[model samples]
Target chain A: MKMPGFDISLVIIWALVAVLVVLAWRRGEGRLQRGLRRGFEMFLINGPRVVVALLAAGFLSYFLPKALIAEWLGHESGWQGILIGSAVGPFFPGGPLVIFPVLVALLKAGAGLPSVFAFLTSASVWGVHRIIMFEIPMMGPRFAAARMIASLALPPLSGLMAVLVIRLLGAPAGVIP
Target chain B: MNALKRKKASLLSEIFGVPFWVFAAISLVMGVLTWQLRGPATVEAAVMGDIDLFLFLVPRMLGGMLIAGLVQVVLPPEVVAKWVGAESGFRGLLIATVVGALTPGGPMTSFPIVVAFYMSGADRGALVAYITAWSLIGFQRFMIWELPLLGPEVALYRVLSVFWMPVLAGFIARRLTIWTAPPPSEEGTR
Candidate 1:
């Protein structure tokens, strides 16, 4: 059976966001609306940039060959998976837009969940955002290195945590195992 | 006129030409691999197809931004000095994480919001952690699309990740100081 609370949760994010926006708007008047509209316009005008980014992401991913990504750094153990996931994962980063559908395809093609989760999380976290915003200007080499080193711990930790949480929640027996 | 053309070219380059090298590098290495629009009418569907996802993401993203802008307004500069502000250390971190996980906007929105918190007196560690957590694990994101597909188990796990990440990031940032407080001056940040 499908879960009941997912929609409720989604609404929570949206509702909170709406409340914040409205409160901000009321206090500031049309200014709030104007800023948001400007942003919306940017999204509209930067249409090509967004498209190219996603398309390029897709094209590059296909070009790189998923198998190669797996073969170079794939691992079975949770710790190893995380380490590999963090290191190799960013090289293949794409936002959820590409990651999920592709992952579903991989699952159908018989990929394991542990690996899938590790890759998906890493895809967003360990990649360019670090370089784009966080690295260089904000955090110099030492800081960047520290963050990356810390992130390296995430994949395996996430894997272990998932298993434990699943077991505790009484995931449908074979749901996790 | 020619000067105008040059200026336009430079501006466009500034806006779009200078790519995120790492992003491109990552994409390229991968591209050598893989791979949003919308609507109702059949023609729109046919023409739009995959673009629907982008369309979907846009409104949600806009919704996020609008909220972020509002958050900026609600928590003004004066009340902040007199009221609840993220100080420093663990307490600051706890506040940051909560803000990060709960706040709805995208990185663009959340990042500025974090700065507002900082100028309002949030600690550096808290700012870093909040930005990291906000962008890294968007709770709203899971609700809309990922949770259904990833299922309860994975969704819960991802949410859990958000809880601890800020903690980890806070501690690390405190020690390193490799962080930025979002710019409170952005009118949106109020």
Candidate 2:
């Protein structure tokens, strides 16, 4: 078991690339060559940044504290818990397979709904790790900075909204299962 | 001497831009620390893993760039502008949010389309909305990962809680861009 690197995503990329190539080919050789050349140049310029960023990401992933999840995000509710959730979200590493189970644990431990909302929102909005490894390298700094600054209010605001919604609907506060 | 130093700095900046150096330094420090503290084996594994990732990235990025370039040539600027341009307003934000949600794959896929649109004259507000929605409500993620792992009740609650984020973020980005003048370089890939 364990192929170490291969995955379905790679297949998806290949399919996508094939489709794009066909699309460009249909357009014309001039446009096709133009796109290919532009894409290569982009890779040349941004490739080093991406490589370094990935290296940094690899090192950073080691330091992510998985054990602290329930401790940090599982207690308290309202503004305090929500604040903690927002703060802790970005620090949690990996995708859904890695993060969701921890989330389920938090729910079982009776973590507050607002805090959970804030945590997920913060993770989605401000996953600084992804910002470094993917967004910054792909999109550039100004775009990243603008988006980051603009979205600063969303996490906690979402948490507050969650509190209101839960109260209005009379939903269970914790323990989903 | 100062003039020479300035020239050298400009050359480096031209090649890599400013953020590259920052990340480079961080990578060096992190790599060294990991090697010492966790032993060389861990560092080796990480390096190899990163190399594998880089290989994967190579094709995806190539395709991504091609899409970006071809889209510009294929799609008329007016169509892009009319839908997602600066003056497209709230409707543009809504359009972007929906598109973002629908977009499949990861950052490699989404960012290219974003750049394509940006170059094609899509507004910053719509771009922000698109990114926000991609990160926040990307339906593929929900369908593939969230529902299976977290269950329906939690997923429903979460959806209810944070659905309004993309539009809000777009509105803010729109207003912010109006106030601040973007640097000439901030325009999408030259």
Candidate 3:
């Protein structure tokens, strides 16, 4: 809930933006204006989608009981939990802001490290929303298809490795909160 | 030139064009269900909570967008492609991975950069590596989001486990591209 790190990160990001804006101004001939305009345009385009997505994520989180999620993704659930996590990843919408928090909640509710990692990997690698909206449209269907096909094994593979590492290192099986 | 190249589309059209509406519809259904199942108070709390999140997100989102713009202006596509073009090989893929990790913004920013690389003769493998690295291992995302939410240990393990993914995906993509490439034409009598 209270993320000091997020606040600090935001400050750093804004500082970087300030430096870049100054540099753009010095670059001469409408560069700064052009860049700002472009940035604003992007914000406008993405803002609505982001709002709807976040609200939806909130509702979804509220609707899905944490106990149920934990049960499905808990440590004792084993490889099945990992599989379910991976399968659910692509369908779990929203950007990092939404996804990470939901994941943290799941972890807090007793989900295993392997399942959490699998969910993160799959969501990042093969998010259906991203693949359809950005990849297919911007990068072409062929490129999207190739990348998806190539990444098909990554979620499970990452989960397997996580499980292996936890066993080998004798680490706690759940997320180390 | 870049200005002309930028696509012009309204927010409404873009939202409707994709499965965004589907997501919205799902959200609406979920909202109604929550209201029915958990009472109106729960729905109100969720909506209010999201509003708080939205306010928190605005500044960060804008900052990210500005950085994305600055990246576009400063790092010319030609320069990016030269460093990660076909001839750059494994080194290119490595550089792409690092670039992708460091490059800021979400898909809206990264995909255009990828398109630029494609036009500038960057290899498909490198492009794939770049996208994969950006999506899977972006340093900014890790530092800002994952560490704060997931904790250091989980984030570290996730990074370690998937660090090799981009290169592997790139390699596979390269092989697939070659396999799918059209066969060389036979010499024919004119």
In terms of lDDT, the best-performing candidate is: 3
Query: How many angstroms is residue A68 displaced in model 2 relative to the true structure, after the best TM-score fit?
Result: 9.4
Taking all chains together, each candidate's TM-score versus the true structure is 0.59, 0.56, 0.72
Using TM-score as the measure, which candidate wins?
A: 3
RMSD of each: 8.7, 10.6, 6.0
TM-score of 3: 0.72
- What is the per-residue lDDT of model 1 for residues A1-177, given as tens digits with 9 covering 90 to 100? 232332543465568766766666677757677556544444343444445454443343333445644543333345565555555557653355456655544443333455666666566556665456645444345544555555555665665665566556644222332
lDDT of each: 0.51, 0.68, 0.74
Worst ten in a row by lDDT for model 1 chain A: A1-10
Whose DockQ is higher: candidate 2's or candidate 3's? 3
- In model 1, chain B matches the true chain B with a TM-score of 0.49
lDDT of 2 by residue, A1-177 (tens): 123344454455456557767887897848777766655555566567667776776676665553454455443445777898888888865554335535554664556678887888888888887889877887688778888888898889878887777677766533432
Q: Residue A80 CA error for candidate 1 (Å)?
A: 4.7
- Model 1, runs deviating above 4 Å: A1-10, A42-80, A92-113, A120-125, A170-177, B1-86, B100-128, B138-153, B172-190
lDDT per residue for candidate 3 within B61-131, as digits (tens), equals: 67766776776676666676566654447787788888888777778777888887776566777777898
Instruction: Output the lDDT of residue A79, model 1.
Output: 57
The DockQ leader among the candidates is 3
